[model samples]
Target: MAVGLVAVGAVVGLEAADRAFPPPLAEAGMVSAEVQDRDGRLLRAFATPDGLWRLRTQARDVDPRFVSMLLAYEDQRFYHHSGVDPRALLRAAFQALTHGRILSGGSTLSMQVARLIEPREARSLGAKLRQVLRALQIERRLSKAEILDLYLTHAPYGGNLEGVRSASLAYFGKEPRRLSLGEAALLVALPQLPERRRPDRNAKLAEAARQRVLDRAAVAAVIGAGEAERAALAPVPATRQALPTLAAHLAEAARRRAPAVMVQRTTVQAPVQARLEALAASAAAKAGPRVSVAIVMADSQSGEILAEVGSAGYLDSARSGWIDMTRVPRSPGSTLKPFIYGLAFEEGLVSQETIIEDRPADFFGYRPRNFDMRYQGDVTIRQALQLSLNVPAIRLLDAVGPSRLMVRFRRAGVRPALPAGEVPGLAIGLGGLGISLRDLVQLYAALANGGRPVQLGDGVEGEPGLVDGAPLIDPVAAWHVADILSGVLPPSGSRRSGIAYKTGTSYGYRDAWSVGYDGRMVIGVWVGRADNGAVPGITGYATAAPILFEAFAKSGVGLTPMPRAPAGAVRLAQAALPPSLRRFSAGPAGLVSARAEDAPLQIVYPPEGAKVELGTDAAGATLPLMLKLQGGRAPYRWLANGKPLTTLSRRRVNPWLPDGAGFSKLTVIDARGRAASVSVFLQE
Candidate 1:
């Protein structure tokens, strides 16, 4: 009797010690990284650090119907019961007495949670008592809801699948937030014998198990008899479904941003992302082998990224699809032409009606030719930009100074990549430098955003825009550019209307791009071999433009044109323009004597990126800006921005009056398209 009393005292002592020091719960807490889209829908899930595909879920992430079915099928009085059910225990005892053997295993959901947390292999009485003790201990520590959450998160579903979210994705290829009656019943039945009744392993056994749940559902009045019968007939999944893997590139980026974080919310809309991924895949297949596609869609109002597809296929080896092409630098053909024209308009150097010659021209031994090797001879500034003429754009770039354009891009948060040790040259006007699709889209978005730049991101989290700096360009210039682009012909068979778009084909056909924007959104697309090798016969107009149009169509956004013309935008004809603007008349301009061949061409007046206000004459009329000559060939053809002046003279001295306020480019082509330029701010 003394020994028995000592044993009871020892048991009490052990219980006290157990309560004083509980086992750490973190041993079972490994969870996968869950990347969600803008609406908080899971975009993709990565395995745990331990390489397990466990996505631990809370009770709220699951369908209420699923939770109810789980409780009804597993434990009827789960809410009322503690660690162990006395009524169930007594019933098991009565059945054991009648049958002279153990009949039902009377384990509450809490006891199962205990087993899951502290597993034991032996089925001995000592082990059973230990499980009961652990359950009671756990009940005292966590609330009923928390205890249920532990079960919902850790319960085995099948094959590497644990928890309802992972199982729901593996079986139904979706979240567990919403489930049909049949789906709920199957999930409820799986945890009983996860591996044994795996749908992929044995559909018959899985279906049979699911039917048993349906039978119970009818008896418990959880569902009508007809509903139960239909649920029982619902076919079980024959194989595990693939998980959500959209936005793979963004998924990796988010992971890198917060490596230790298990869940990351990114700036992407789930539906648009999914459709763009599908469209990318389709474009790749049709573009032949070794070809890949990249696309970006952003909101102009807030600069939020709606969709970004880095490649056609993340696992496609032939196309080097793992590369994030949106961030990659490639030549941006005529995509920068609109910006060039916009700057000219801001400077009042030229209006849309100012005539410019598109003939072959040379500057400092560098001759410029059109893409098709044919010249339009004479075209207005509006026509020149719309047609993307090489010579005219080069003349504008020469005057604007390529470096100045680069500075404007930087202010707008974009940087184009240039060759090592190479200076900005007139070639840059015709796709000479490299710019990423992402940066290009951001620049175009500025035009749609009324000359302001909205930082690109998912709006769930704030992405800061330009830090209180001046707008990228004058609103009137931006408006004019948008209006001109809106009139550019759309690709064949495109049903879209009113999208201001531009197409670009890089040198050697290495890259093709089509970026477009409406009043509120911008989308940029790139099609090419990710390896940077040339892909012949694929022009931006033929390949990438169509994809861009289709992407906007599938994006479910209404098409809106650019906002109304900003203040200072004037509608005038060639005859209505001022005498100085009536006809572009640029004289031969030089920084050195006409006979000085050793000196490189340079701008003498209105220095590079200089802000110059108009000087008034005796009559109070603005005096012309003096042009000095020094180097290069005589009879230089001068241009204000891209417009050819009516005069081509051997005399070095030239004159240009300020027509308005804003930025302007002044260029002088010395026989060759090889030219000298300066970007100056002209003020009235």
Candidate 2:
């Protein structure tokens, strides 16, 4: 009765001690932050706060053979024992006592995991007893599988690497899901003396350690002797591989967003990201030490950013590579011209063949000149855009209110940065405003997706999806712009990619940009110093366009044909165009005289048999009729009912008051006596 009472008291005391000191299970939650591709391939990983590469690992993520080998080598009775194996411990103690030295520690996998969670510097008996007690507590709280997971996650593998996954990736350059016999054995033997037998630093020791695991596995009948011999012949990796850093910038950004999440999944495709990263690095090296490159490739239909190269090299100090140029707002130069033309097309102000003057022009004190300082006398609307003429774009932007153009841009899921306290103006069409490469890509994606705007996501923020706003432009107008841009000739020595693209160069050669798209994918490239410093003689056509074409070639995505012409979209010849669309003229505010080379004279406004409204003001005086014409020889004559109402005029616009509110005929005769007449009913 006394013995039984003593035993019960000891048990009660042990239970109270266990309750007083619970295991630090929360340490298991501190794992390395990882950024993975859509398919779960690691793009980049940031170390834990303690500077350890301790990735979270699960038994299912490792090869079954490796797991079996680890169990067999570390703890033969792992499945049978709750936390400690008595038979193994007795044998170790007997051998140590008989030999007068500690030959084996008799530690189970659970004890090893406990030590990993709370490491101790001394190998004293007290430390061992503490580990054994912690192991018991761990087993009571966690299942066998969870304990194994902790071991797999916290097991040391030399240097800063902790987890089997990090070790495997570093030594073998692949995942642990599919390891060879030799590789499995090596990994099973690593955690025992990780630093002394590191494959990268001590290949001979690593090989010897692996051989011992193989020989033991054979003797234990886990593998045949013949198979062990074959596995022994396999060579150990002599060097450690640098882990994947394909999307470094994006990975860092994702970590900042969700610091607590162990693994952050992105929409990035690993293959595409790898290829573009290589391209950006190579391109930057060739460009110059100070020049940096940024590229963004996205799906127009899904709005997913397949690959985003934020800089030429994330660590290139000369190029300020840490800056994410894709998101940095800078002058876009002439890249915004297409949208201006599209707005004009949507407003029925011009057609593809409309003759628009590219001569130097002024808009409310803002004068925009051609890039070459020489203008194409009177080019078609298509030619003006294909040539990237500055004056023509400003003219179109002036006609279609700049504020309206900005509204369209907002529909495309981006708001361009305007100068402080300044309203949208014509200079914006000439690269006066700032926009990022991502914003530009989003806008072009809308153009490629038939004017339907899509909001892009880089897997870091959210899924790429369609925007709820209206289309950026009408389908017909978008098609017209695509048709014109597609006809733009490729850069010298480069083959056509069958994609619609545009190029731009900011003022002072600060930035060169190229954006292109097929039916499905859109890519934008920027070449400049990240510090916003100028690189002389750098033009978009000569520098950025080639990179754009090369990216399309190397992106590994098949070309999706541009969308077919939408309803109401047609390429009209100059002669077949509507009178208004045949020749584009700026409003009275920014109009310039038409040269003799302009299209034949014709009255654009007040189409034949149309009603004219001339409402009176508060003064009750008759308001004069405003007549507008398109092309005409200078010094034109205007007549009402065969009577000359005004002397010969050099301007295409004229005003007249009808004798009374009734049917009237108006005629315009140019210097060549070529007359075009329009009849209309007047109403007050």
Candidate 3:
């Protein structure tokens, strides 16, 4: 019965083999090839359906040492075998049966290549017989050198790496040709158990597998015993390279735009990218758990983004896979103030010397206060901007009209996120509208580049404007705004000042911003909690300004002072005395009389010098000068030659009529008891 059953089984197996026999396997063809930049280095690979993960070709010449080591460890008789080795298969089958599980693969290099090229669905007993038949067919059709080349170029080692070229780069972080003997052995050992032999995940197991390759190489006489020993003992150069979080983000972005088939050529510079990564890493390390940082660096002249750092580390749980914060929109705080001011200047609604009241005022229920809650009563447009006085900015915003400012912002590439039907108010000047850092940087660049709005894109040229001929704003106005901004550096309190900048804090300190430009570069910085919570006791001037200064100072971009305004483009004037000093007079004997209060105040000469005689006919004649008081009230008393005259009400001054050529002193006492005296010459 047993003999009959064996005959039946053998007959059935023969029948199954006959039925399973299909057409001989053809050589695996290329599928898709992808090229990408890894940490600024270019890498290319080919993907095949049935091979490892992807197949990659050697860059130029195959590294003979790597090939020799792989052949020695994987298939000692690879050169002599025709696709399949019967003797090795019998030995492997015996070991598997005794162990009750498969422990080794006795397939020759050609058989492995067949497995790689053919579908795994063909792995049945009958399928294995077919694979053997196909192996014989492949050997008959291709030469030994061709088979070796196909195997080396098409086999998958691990992790999206199809061939030895990619495996060399992925595993050892070096080219195949540059790999050392031990490194080559490491690659050779990985294919047998790719997952278990990953160096990053299983160092000990990988090391053990590496030793197995060394042992095999020795047995095959691929290397001398001493050489093999030395190679095994050599340090593995154990460093692992990982893509930084920011670099990874950029890579992913590049991949998205081009996919696996198209190669991406970006404007990102490797050295600049390295520096940006370092800066982001340092910032992340310093910021700790609560804070995350994102940075974007671009060329001011060309608007080419040179570098970008998205986060501290790619694997960081808190920030990993988050949308790039640098590109996202957030409340710009005071960073938007310059644009508003620039618009006002361009429209001829205000100038650097224009007086702006900085006192407390409400605009449509929104009352903007200075960061310190301190008010400056009256200041020039230049001083208000330099000091970042909130009240003055709010007043200026009201004067310039919020709708008009919004139009200018849109023209500059900033799409403000203000609600429709929302009345523009003082808050608008304080960056109440949402804006992106990219937009802010571009706006500032417009000012730096002479009023030309930069077209923000990978390589698109900005439209020709006032600077470039499209005329978004008068180049002169933009230049004037730049001049005012250039004086805002080092903060109002810092001793070192050379930068024109503006600082802004959002409601509750959720965001802080410092945006500024020199002749050559425009930079904007934002500091805040990623969660949109206030940083206790921090403001734009205190937080973002320092960072901006550091970036510019370290960037090696020299500061070029903005061009000065023409001789008569702007002028300055001091506030006049209070109304009480308008009328007061000095007597003939150099005495000031109480009755002089009714006399009209006038200047016989300018301050700092005077000549007068009370009896002179010229002295009795009225002078044309009059007193002008600024925004406050104060008491005043007039004196001639150290004699007290009549007390004058706010802004009240007495006129002086000179009689003959002589010098007379006039002293004016303020409400605070402060006195200023001047002498005028009485000329006939």
Candidate 4:
């Protein structure tokens, strides 16, 4: 048989010599190396041109237990045999024939190393002869320990993971020194069928293969029979090291900063990253498999992204492999509206007291509707923002003009994917433009940092810019917007408190978002399908808001109110208005009669106090106030002090004095009978 194989090889060699076939070259001193994190954590690894099939022989520092287990299970006579075991080869061939499959392999560890260093092109008689020759050549040139070291370092365990060093960390989450006898056995069994023995893929089959290793060890006298039995029966402790999604994202981000060949120091806190991953996984499990989620958390002042979850799972997973929903641009929904209204206030285009008509109106070809599909006509700019009114936002956008608004968004660090010549309509205020969740978080971070622009970084050094331009919104305007947004909590509009939040749902419910900021951090969350399918009954308020709240709560991030504007920051009054209502004025006097067509009514006294205290019923009291009128007729509803008087017959009545309990608000209805509001401070 040996002579026949040699004859066949000679014939094949002649045919191959006439062709381009080259003899596999054997080289000395070839080695592959890997870099790992402290605690034997797998950071990265590389393979040589010889490929990843060479016999791995660990350094003397490597645990002897791992080496013992490898030889005991793989080739019992590895130390004594030159390269091949003639008796074992015959037995393996017989077993293969009886099983009618390639269930057993006869290659000794040394032969495997030979094939790895000088790989065969085909699994035929000629290739086998060449492999045998090379194995003998290797045995003559290297010692037993050297051969074992080569085999240990170059074996492919599974996936991109190679070598026992990497496999030890990947599976057992421990160093070879820490591996138990059972774990050592499991690692040894993997080289035979790495895929079938993968812990994450087929844990049961892997355990069975591990048991076989212990049985073979005992039979070969490599381990005592009692020891082998105990090892075989020992429970494999569940791996404690979970692959963190956020950590993976941070690593990817770090890799971008430096090549994979270079080590990167990242700002990722393992505990924080683990918490973020847990929160995202819990949220995703509750959200169901179809809903894709992305979260980005950043430091408001430093603009460093502390945590980011690109998707629920790795991008390579079959179920979650389409688009990277986090990076893809989607309509930011109402999350972008705050910036528009914020820019308006900052630019002096509008003020909290400025009465904007919230009645339904059409712009050219687009008609915008509120989330509830209800019209709230004549709402104050403050109320418009607090309630997230659609019409008021569009009206404000109309007043600011799309061109200038887009410029403000760009300045605020929002890069909307609006096409050239695509007019920014009223819808843009309600997230008509597509933007990424990362951009949304950066924009909110800018708002939290006092209108200072944000720079998106992968925990690397970079200057934070105010989008494409200088600071667009004035500090005072940004402060006011934050102040109003902070009040939109549960029973008000959101379940999150102390957070300047905005919830948005795009048309067709393709995307839902809740982006906001507290005193120190800015958070942006997105929920939807990777395929852009609308999740039934899933709205931004229902999906994204709660996730944001839960994430902040779990992270123990408190919501401290942003600091008040500095002492010198100028607070501009309603000085800059459109020419139509610029002339309309009312003095420091309380609610006076007005017409609806003139201007929607506004209060100018008590400084339009927010969070003012008043008795539940101030039956008869004199309240100092002022009234400014915009377009509209008013048979204004009257309030005694800060309480509403049933009749407007008597403007001043002594019976309206404070009862000294709960707060009171005086609201007036226009002649059009729309709700008009005013507040006054009353000492209890």
CA-RMSD of model 4 = 16.2
* TM-score on alpha carbons, each prediction: 0.84, 0.84, 0.58, 0.55
lDDT of 4 by residue, 395-449 (tens): 6565444555665566665657864556555667887777888888888888898
Q: Which ten-residue region of model 4 has the weakest summed lDDT?
A: 583-592
Residue 602 displacement (Å), model 4? 20
Q: Candidate 1's C-alpha lDDT?
A: 0.79
> Among all windows of ten consecutive residues in candidate 2, which has the lowest summed lDDT?
588-597
Clash totals for all models, in order? 21, 0, 54, 39
lDDT of 1 by residue, 145-264 (tens): 988888888788877788888999999888899998889999998988899989888888888888888888788887888998877877888889888898888888878778888888
Candidate 2 structure quality by residue, lDDT tens digits, 256-288: 898888898998999999998899889888888
How many clashes show up in model 2? 0
lDDT of 4: 0.64
Lowest summed lDDT window (length 10), candidate 3: 581-590
Which has the better lDDT: candidate 1, or candidate 4?
A: 1
Ranking by lDDT: 2, 1, 4, 3
| Candidate achieving the largest lDDT | 2
